[model samples]
Target: MALATVGGCGSAEPSQQTETDDSAVVLPIIPAGTKADSILVDKSDRTLILYKGDEEIARYGNIRFGDTPEGHKRFEGDERTPEGRYTINGRNPGSRYHLSLRISYPNAADRAYAEARGKSPGGDIFIHGQPNGREGAPLASDWTDGCIALSNAEIQQIWETVPDGTEIYILP
Candidate 1:
């Protein structure tokens, strides 16, 4: 219900605008012509937001998640999306899913948590499009093994707008 609400936090701040000169405009956090410098996933709202500096550039709503999409993922097959910060580590254009953007899951804390419980912290988590067949793999709120699922067209736009190494903060 809160799809319009967006919060911004980043490691670096954009340069402040000044009356010095228009030519002194500082470069954006994203690359030239890119739309977003980073992304934020709000699991509770089932929404993913793209940000360029402190501004919310885009919002993708009605997202799908794991079968058991609450809490931090404890094992490889927990069917829960992980919470915390991650990066867009890789991209697969020809993925079984229409297209995929890999998110670095099982970070040190995640691994240590699973290790303490004697479980395998899952890997290969992604923000991906609907599958190539079957009329949408993640067609419901709880459908994936833990990855974020968006529509095919949505993923294509994300693929073009978001670059690898973009920080993606997934919130619980």
Candidate 2:
């Protein structure tokens, strides 16, 4: 039986590491017992913001996405990060990337839309860190197959703050 690799950032190719003179990336200090209830990703701005109720808790800039990085993903290999509301359903501590939070893509509407056209609605979207064993600065361009990418340090912060079942809204 042929096994299929589902939703990961898809490429084994190493993204070009960046060299910057900017100061080290600093994560915002969340107060003890604080947890994020929601996440928002703005594709046009390339940012991911975490929220606790109506208050903003953390924001990650320079977030990377699929090569196309323009619109909602409808089918497999579209190279587009999905837009709309999704839940963070799982966590991957042993991911190929540093750490990952799974996004529930292909909700019923997504599946119907794709199946209506006789195409598969790909699943397995995630918000994850830089690929494992990668060092230096994060990649300088959009690189993931469809999932969102963050720096290793940034992901560590997110991993701690975002629990499973958090609602995420990805906006184009």
Candidate 3:
């Protein structure tokens, strides 16, 4: 099966703002900020990767997907992971996990599908870390509420690398 990677072909592009110094100025800190292109989740492989454009900047292993990885999410308590394109909607500093990045699920298609069935497309999908101080759990088992699971260090790396509103695509 092909990896459910996100985005089309493109080079890694960091939105940089170059500045000039006036009297041999010394830099204090360098910022590695870039516009996040996409996040790839391979449930079969249990890996979550962050990409800037097409370059893989950070890869988090020991990740987990929905309990049932058969198809896209259908309804609440389906225990199925969502497939297709999505985006990073928001961030949660306070979460059951150490931290989380919200995924923009229920896109127009999802909404329409749910609406057609007269059901609420269950929400609150996230790319989050393991339970508080238990970041090691994700490495042990596939435990999550339908959201992609990562470790604390991995989540922090993602939190710092990708900005909010970045496009994320999850495939089957």
Candidate 4:
């Protein structure tokens, strides 16, 4: 499938650097006070990667998604994580989850597609941590309504490193 890309939101584009030896994964050297400008979510791999300019800053694996986790989300309650480009539009410290970074899903194309079918394109998608009152290892299965999930510590790191308006590309 063709990868979907959107115009930059006035931020630097992200690029991945690989070692000459294909088997080795070279992590980028990020200076102190640096922040991620973009994020990439690979649904098939269940991973979320953070990038700064052309360098990968961090990569979180074992990410979880909605119960029905494949494919682009089309309507409310589909339980499918959306596939495409979006932005981290907001954050919620008081969210029921440990911490949350909002994703700007249901873009123009999403709305049009759902409207044509007379269904509501769901909103309120986010990348968040475990439930606020829960304490332990992360859940073992796909459980969100349609949001991406990470561990509390992982989300805390992401919350501090990623700013609002960071571009995110969710892929299948």
Candidate 5:
């Protein structure tokens, strides 16, 4: 067996345990009953905004789109973000791209649109953290399978603030 230590000169023993006291840390807790009413994603500005009714809860810029990065996502492997109204239907804290909040893509309209063209309205869209474990990675490009990309830190804040079933509007 072998052990790899981070930032170690030679010896691999850790100086401190990897745990924190919630009570001791002055955490920025979300307000009680402060539920997010909607999420707005502006493709032009590359921004994602979280709102509680009329008031803005949190907003993040420098967002990334898909690899193709233009217009609505049509069929499977389009590599384009979708533009429509949807709900945050599912959550995955343990995901391949860090934490993820699943978007309910391929709604009735999308399915119909694709089906009419004899295509598959690809599913499994989400607002997720950056690649490489979603911990802390600088975003460099629009490269995804039609999923919105955010920094791991931004996703963490969103995970805490936005609850499932909240509405999301992705704009073109």
Candidate 6:
């Protein structure tokens, strides 16, 4: 049997006494709440605005969209972000990107359309941070699988402010 050593400087040795470390680090927490009336995604400006009953509360810009930013997403693998009124259903902290807020895509109409076309409805759409490669890149282009993209810090703020079931509308 072969053993690996730390720093690659010596042979590894197994300890006769089994020692287990039990320590945990606690992080400060933020409460969940919906303080906005609706969230608007302006495809033309590539910005997201949070409103409270017609009054603007906060705005997040430099958002990225799908590869093809044409009409609303009509089918699977269209690479087009959906544009319509929907609700934020849930949040995912273990997203491929950073944290994310799940958008209720493929509504009833979307499902029916995909079913009529005999195709599967694409899923896993979200408003998330940049991917690992593009994390440090400046927001210059619209390139995504089919979801809205934000900066890592912006996403963390959104995750804290926007609770599940918040209404959102994506416009063309």
Lowest summed lDDT window (length 10), candidate 1:
1-10
TM-score per candidate, chains pooled:
0.77, 0.88, 0.75, 0.82, 0.79, 0.76
Residue clash pairs of candidate 4: none
Q: Write down the lDDT that model 6 would get.
A: 0.68
lDDT of 1 at 155: 70
Local accuracy by lDDT, each model: 0.71, 0.82, 0.64, 0.77, 0.72, 0.68
- Please identify model 5 stretches exceeding 4 Å from their true place: 1-33, 134-136
Root-mean-square deviation of every model? 14.0, 4.8, 12.8, 11.3, 10.1, 13.3
Candidate 3: RMSD over Cα atoms? 12.8
| Candidates 3 and 5, the one with greater TM-score | 5
- How close to the true structure is residue 77 of candidate 2, measured as C-alpha lDDT? 88
Candidate 4 off by > 4 Å: 1-31
Give the candidates in order of TM-score, highest first.
2, 4, 5, 1, 6, 3
TM-score of model number 4: 0.82
lDDT of 3: 0.64
Candidate 2 per-residue lDDT, tens place, 100-147, comes to 788889799999999999999887788988777676788789988899
Clashing residue pairs found in predicted model 3: none
Find the candidate with the highest TM-score and give its number: 2
Instruction: Write one digit per residue (lDDT tens) for candidate 1, span 117-161.
Output: 888897878887665553423355567888898766667678788
- What 10-residue stretch in candidate 2 is worst by lDDT? 10-19
Give a tens-digit lDDT track for model 6, residues 34-69: 476589999888878877688776787768887887
- Tell me which of candidates 1 and 2 scores higher on TM-score: 2
The TM-score of predicted model 3 comes to 0.75
Candidate 2 structure, TM-score to reference: 0.88
Candidate 5 residues 8-105, lDDT tens each? 01112323211122222122346766768899999999988889888887778888888888799888878888899999987765455546787888
What's the true lDDT of residue 88 in model 6? 87
Tens-digit lDDT string for candidate 3 (14-122): 2221212212222122147654577888776766777777777666666677677668987766767788888887776655555667787778888889889998777
